[model samples]
Every structure is written in structure tokens, then in C-alpha cells.
Target: MSDVFDYIVVGGGSGGAVMAGRLSEDAGTRVCLLEAGGRGDHPLVRTPMGTVALLRTRLHNWGFETVPQAGLNGRRGYQPRGKGLGGSSAINAMIYVRGHRSDYDGWAAMGATGWSWDEVLPYFKLSEHNERLQGPLHGQGGPLWVADSRTGNPLHQRFMQAAQQAGFALNDDFNGERMEGLGAYQLTQKNGERWSAARAYLLPHIGRRPNLQVHTGAQVLRVLFEARRAVGVELLQGGHRRQLRARREVLLCAGALQTPQLLMLSGIGPQAELARLGLPVLQHLPGVGRNLHDHPDFVFAYELPTLDAVGFTLGGGLRMAREAWHYLRQRRGMLTSNFAECGGFVSSRPGLVAPDLQLHFLVALMEDHGRRLHRAHGVSCHVCLLRPHSRGTLTLRSADPLAAPLIDPAFLSDPRDLDDLVAGFKLTRRLMQAPAMAAGVRREVFTAGIETDEQIRAVLRARTDTVYHPVGTCRMGRDDGAVVDPHLRVRGVHGLRVVDASVMPAVVSGNTNAPTIMIAEKAVDLILGRSRAHGASMPAPVGAGADVPA
Candidate 1:
């Protein structure tokens, strides 16, 4: 491989894969992608049930932990980011959600020009190939496949039924016209197997494109610069140090947590902090590690009879053996379950403009991001505040590039966020108590006798953590506090950009994977100067920015 290229994309996750894949489409330009982990096509990543194992292990995951959070009674929160080529998409739940339309509109409102719902809707459609749904909203024949879950488990249906019985509306498509009701989620899958960003964009074109070179296990130490322009990157591979140059640009898609850390390590951050660490400051952008926030989530777990749901009992073990065979033959069964099979969006109060709380219903008991295990059959539901008012920061632990960043989400620091979570607990408890789901209930594992608001608040303070949607460390906007511009370019640097969830001005109202993919799709156009022409026009979203169906 050559030492120089037209573009160098760091991190082969959702955004980096798309950037490299799209940039290499022009045969004249050379593109290189660097990933810190191995090829993400492991059997554990391909199987849908592999996510449960992936959460607790570092095999394909960067099992990162936060600095002790005062919100959760001073417990460190778990953050599992995907390693390898597919990034988090390889290890995530595979739920395909584009957040609310207002999320994009809100971005534009925050000075991220050309990022309104209508402006960015075309990119969302451009990256999707939905097998079931078709319309102006969904796309066909795209690289990323979006389809319904193959799990025929009735528990998912029962959860939705219980939601309906609790007086919530049924939303067939969360990514369609509206995103505010109880229903099953569409996944990023192909014929019941995991279809990650690597599979969709980078994998098939690896050897096919002579200009595209992908390197795994390449840990980038820092961005190489000439004066102010980002020229290349210094990386560590096989215990050897090397430098690769980018003739056109260097893109950072290392995700929210690591992206900011990289920026700081590269001498582009708060000047005082950078100088305090004995690192030279190239740009004094205070927003490099500021505005860090995430979905503060609390799970309500229940122990139920070992029926169709998965458990650790002898019968469940025997059933899982049968399921393995069933999955091997037909690619359909309990093994195909994403665990978070059912969920929806709802408002905690009457006056909210959009659904403020999102839910993820699981068929098995989960605690601490599946790190804690139980021996009984169970069900779990997660309720997370969609947009948190409280913010935190991501800072360097030391000058060492390999050291993990000190991540402080400062969850629930804003009392209103805690208030909303308390309301969500009450609301979720109601759904669990409904006749459809109530009959199967054995015992509430977490909140058994929690009744009053004060009790709910206390439980929330003890158990609240992240739903794995951390964002906004490298915020995108036109203000000085913004780390990147509306075009995703670094504020004071040339030939550099950030094209990942880190650039989101605020966390969206749903799972972040799909939106991260959409960001890359649009960023490709921006890099090619074809932004004005590529998918720039489409029918306006139905009731754009309006409240979802009640």
C-alpha cells in the first residue's frame, strides 16, 4: 500500500466506512481506512444473539467505563463501543432508527445549516434498503438493509399489546411518517443475519476497488499536521509505529467518546487544559470535549415463567440448543432475536412537542448492560430520557494515547431530567401492569413496592445509566463553542473533518446508529462538493416537526 492517499478515514465504524466506501467510488482518488480492531465479521458479530455476549466482553467491544457518576449513587457507567471494521454497528442491537424529524430541524435551528429534516431526509433514504416498507420515506436497493426481525417470539407482540392496553397508540413504522407509538423495531439485517456498515459499504468493495485500502488493528496515535492543515495520521500497528498521509483530507469518525479524545491528543482543544497536560495547542476550541450528554436510562426488570422467553434454566438451555439448530437450518428462531425486540416512544407529560422518553422491551433480564446475569426467566424494559438537559465532558486521563478518556456524562445533573425519568418509571410500570403483560409477570426485580414519586426518584438515582447513545462532545454548529462547522470541518484546521455522532449538536430522540449512518451519507456529498445535487429534493416529511400520534 502507498504511504499517501487522497483521503484517510480514521475508525472503520458506521461513518468512516461510508466515507471511505463513497470516496473510493471515484477511481482516480485513493482512500485509506484505519481501524484499531480486527475484521468485524466474526461469528459472534454475525449472529443476532451475539450482542448479549459482545456487551460483556472486549472481543469486538471497547468496554469503556465512565468516571464515577454522582447521579447513579456514584457508580461508574458502562459504555460498550464497537471495535473492528463495522464499529458499534457490529455489536449493537441492530435497531434502525433515524430519530425524530425535529432532531434534524433542531440541528438546523442551532446553526447547522443545510441539516434540517427536509434537507437531510434524502440521505436517510439513500442509505436504506428496506425489505418490508416502501414509500417516499424509505429507499430500496441501498447498501444497508433494513428489515423486520425474524424472531417469531410472541413475547414481543405481547409487549406491544400491553402498551396498547395501557392506552398508547401502535406505530407500525418508527422511521416512517411518525415516531411516537409502541411497536416492533426494524433492524439492520440481511436475511436474518447482521448487516453492519462494513457489510453494507466497505466489505464487498475491499478488494474490488484498487484505490481503497482498509487496515485493521491500526491504532492511530494522533493526526499529523503541517502548520494548521491535517496532512495525515500517526498510527500504531503490530507494535510498530507508522505514518500515512492524506493528500486531500483526513476524516475522524472515531465516535463521540474517542473522537474528542483524539482531537485533544492532536492539540486541538481547550488551550488551558491542553497546556496543562504539556501538549501544544494548535486550536483553542473549548467545545472539543464539552457538551457531552447521553440518554439516561433505567431498566425495569421482572422474573417470569420460563416460557418462550430466554433464561438460564435447564429447560431454557435445552430450548437454546434446539434454537441453535433451528437458526443454523432456517435462520429463524429465538437465536435471531435482538433481545430488545419491542419498544416505542411516548411523552412523559401532556405539553411536550415530541416523545421525550423512548422504551426498549427485552425478552430476558438485563442489568448493567448485560454484564449482570440472573438464573431465572425474565423480561426487561428500558425507559430513557430522549434529550437530556444536563451535559458533561470527555477529557484526557493522561498524555498516553492508549489510556481511556475520563468520560463524565454527569447524568441527571439537571433535576428536570431526573423528574422526567421518574415520570417514565411510573409510565412504564403502568404498561407492565397491563393485563396483556401482567398475567406473565412473576415478580418485579427492581421496583417491587415503589409507589410514590419520591420512591421512584430514589430508585432512579440508584439505577440510572446510559442506553449507549452518548453524543455532542465535538458539537457541530456555527458558534465558537462548536467543534466543527456545519460542513463538518474542524473550526480552525484545514483538510480535516469529523463525520460521526460526535458532531451532532444534540442527542437525537432515538437510537443513534441510523442517524450516524445518515450523517456519513450526507458528509460524502459535502466532501465531493456534490452536496447541492445529491438527494437534495424529496417530498416533505408528513407533519414534519409535529407531535407524534397520541
Candidate 2:
């Protein structure tokens, strides 16, 4: 392989995979993709149910932890990021969601020009190949596959029934004309297997495209700069230090947490902090790691008598044998379940511009993010504050490139977040108590007797953590403090762009994987100086507006 390339994409995650794959499509362009993890084609990654093991171990996970959070009663929070080519998309629950249209419009409103709902809608359609639905809102013949959940679990119907009984509307498609309703979420799966971003974009063209090279287990130390222009990257691969040059541009898609850390390590963050860490300053961008935020989530778990949901009861073990046999034969059943089989978006209070609270109804116990085990069948639901007022930071834990970054999500730092979550908790509890759900429940694990607002607040502080959607650490805006420019180029530098979740000025209203993919799709056009006049010129369909906020 050559030591130089037209483009170098760091971190083969959701965004980098797309950037690398699309950029290399031009036969003249050479692309090098560097990933710190593995190839991401293991059976564990392909099987939807393998998320249990993936989340619990470092097998295919980064398994990062946060600094002690004062908002969560000083407890450290768990952050399990995917550690392979597909990144988090390899191990996520596979629930495909493009956040409310207002999210992108709000970005353009915030000075990220050409990123409104209408402007970016085409890229979304361009990236997706919906297995069921197709319209102006959804694309066809795209690489990333989106399909309805294959789990034949009866609990899906019960959850929908319970939502309707609780007076929430049922939405057949969350990514369609409306997002405010309860329903089953589509998955980034195909024919009952996980179809991660790498599976969709990078892996297929690896050996076929001689111009594209993918190097896994390559840990990037920092961006190599010629004066102020990023020219290449210094990485550690196979226990050897190597420097690969980029002839055209270097794209950082290392995700929200590590992207800023890489910037700070490369001497492009707050001057004082860089000096304090004994690193030279290239640019004093204080906002490199300043706008960190994620959805603060609380889970409600309940124990049920039957073996319908996933669990470890004696009867459930026998059922698992049958399930395995059925899965091997037909590729369906509980084995195909993403656990978070169904979810929804809804407003925490009336008159909100968009759904402020999102719910992921699981047919299994997700106690401590599935770290804690139970011997009984149960159900779990997660309610998260969609757009949090609170923000946090990701800083260098040490100068060591291999060390984990210091993550302080400052969750619920703004008391209003807790207030909204309290309302969301009450609303979710009501849904659980509805007749459809109540009939199967034997006991409520937590919050059984909690009734008052104060009690809810206490439990929330005791249990709230992240739903794994962290973004905006490398914020993009026209403001002086923005880390990257509107086109995602690193300010004060040439030939460097960040194409990942980190560039989001505000976190989206739902699962961020799809939006992150959309960002990469839009960025490919920006990088190549291609006009949106061709395939990506579709406007947002009628009635695709947010239910509340215009």
C-alpha cells in the first residue's frame, strides 16, 4: 500500500465509513481509513441479540466510563462505544431514527448553512434503502438497509396497545411525516442480520477497490500539520508508529468524545488547557470540547411471570433452545430481537415544539445497561430528555493517546432537565400501568411506591444516565467560538474536516445514528464540491414538519 492518499478518514465509525466509501467511488481518488478496533464482521456484531455480550465486555466495545458525575449523586456513568469499523452502529440497538426535521432547520438557523430539513433531506433519502416503505421521504436502492423489527415477540403488540390505552397516538413510521407518537422502531438490519454502516459502506468495497485501504487496530495519535494545514496523521498500528499523508484532505470521524480529544491532543484546543497539559498550541479554539451533551435517560424495569420477554428463568432456558433452533432454521424469533424492539417520540408536556422525551420500550431487563443479571423475565422502558439544556465537556485525562478521555456529561446540571424527566417518568409509568401492560407484570422493580414529584426526582438522580447519544463537542457554527466551520472544516486550518456526530450544534431529538449518517452523506458532497442539483436535491415532503415547532 502507498504511504500517501488523496483523503485520510480517521475512525471507521458511522460517519467515517460513509465518507471513505463515497469519496473512493471516484476511481481517481485514493482513500485510507484508519480504525482503532477490528474488522467488525464477527458473528457477535451481525447478530442483533449479541448486543448483550457486546455491551457487557470489551470484545468489540470501547467500554468507556465517565468521570464521577455530581448530577447523578457522584456516580460514574457507563459509556459503551463500538470499537470497530462500524463504530457504535456495529453494536447499537439498530433502531433507525432520523430526528425531527426541526433539528436540521435549527442547525441552519444557527448558522450551519445548507443544513435545513429541506436541504439535508435528500442525503437521508440518498443513504437509505427502506425495506418496506418508499416515498419522497424515504429513498430506494441505497446502501444502508432499514427494515422493521423481525422479532415475532407478542410484546410489541402489547406495548402499542398499552400506548394507545394511555392515549398516545400510534405512528407507523417515526422517520415519516410525523415523529410524535408511539410505535415499533425500524432497525438497521436486513434479512434478520445487523447491517451496520461498515457492512453497508466500507466492508463491501475493501478488496475490490485497489485505491481504498482500510487499516484496523490503528490508533491515531494526532493530526500532522504543516504550519496550520493538516497534511496527514500519526498513528500506532500493529505496535508500530506510522505517518500517512493525505494529498487532498484529512477527515476526522472519531465520534463526539474522541474527536475533540484528538483536536486537543493535536494542539488545537483552549490555549490555557493545552499549556497546562504541556502541549503546544496550534489554535486556541476554546469550543473544541465545550458543548458536550447527551440524552439523560432513566430506565423503568418490571418483572413479569411469563417467559415472553428475554430472561434467565428455568422455563425461559428451554424456550431459548427452541428459539435457537428456530433462528438457525428460519432466521426469526427472539434471537433477531434488538431488545429495544419498539420505541417512540413524544412531548413531555403539551405545547412543546417537538417531542422532548423519547422512549425505548424493551422486552427484557436492561438493569445497569444489561450488566446486572436477573433470573426472571421482565420488561424495561427508557425515557430520556431529548434536547437537554445542560452541557458538559470531554477533556484529556492524560497526555497518553491510549488513555480514556475525561468525560463529564454534567447531566441535569440545569434543574429544568430533571423537571422534564420527572414528567416523562410519570407519563411512562402510566403507560406501564395501563391494562395491556399491567396484565403481564408481576411487580415493578424500581419506583414501585414512588408517587410524589420529590420522590420521582430522587429516583431520577439516583438512576439517570445516558442513552448513548453524545454530540456537539466539536460544534459547527458561524460563531467565533465554533470548533469547525459550516462546511465542517477545522477553523484556522486547511484541508481538515470533521464529519461525525461531534459537529452537531444541538443534539437531535432521537437516536443519533441515522442523523450522523446523514451528516456524512451531506459532507461527501461538500468535500467534493458537488452541487446538490443532481440526486440529492429533493425537498422535504409535505406534512413532514414537526407537530409542534414550525
lDDT score, candidate 1, position 432: 92
Task: Give candidate 2 misplaced runs (Cα > 4 Å).
Answer: 532-550
**Collision count for each candidate, in order:** 0, 1
Model 2 pairs in collision = 353-549
Instruction: Estimate the Cα RMSD of every predicted model relative to the unseen true structure.
Output: 5.1, 4.8
What tens digits encode model 2's per-residue C-alpha lDDT throughout 1-550? 5799999999999999999999999899999999999999999899899998999899879999998989899999999999999999999999999999999999999988778999888888989999999888998888999998877888999999999999999999999998999999999999999999999999999999988999999999999999877899999988999899998889999999999999999998988889998999998888999999999999999998778898888899999899888878888888899999888988877888889999999989779889999989999999999999999999998878889999988999999999899999989998989999999678899889999998999999999998999999999887877988777888777778899999999999999999999999988887766745254433332222211110
Residue range 359-389, candidate 1, lDDT tens digits: 9999999988888898899999999999899
Give the alpha-carbon lDDT of every model: 0.91, 0.90
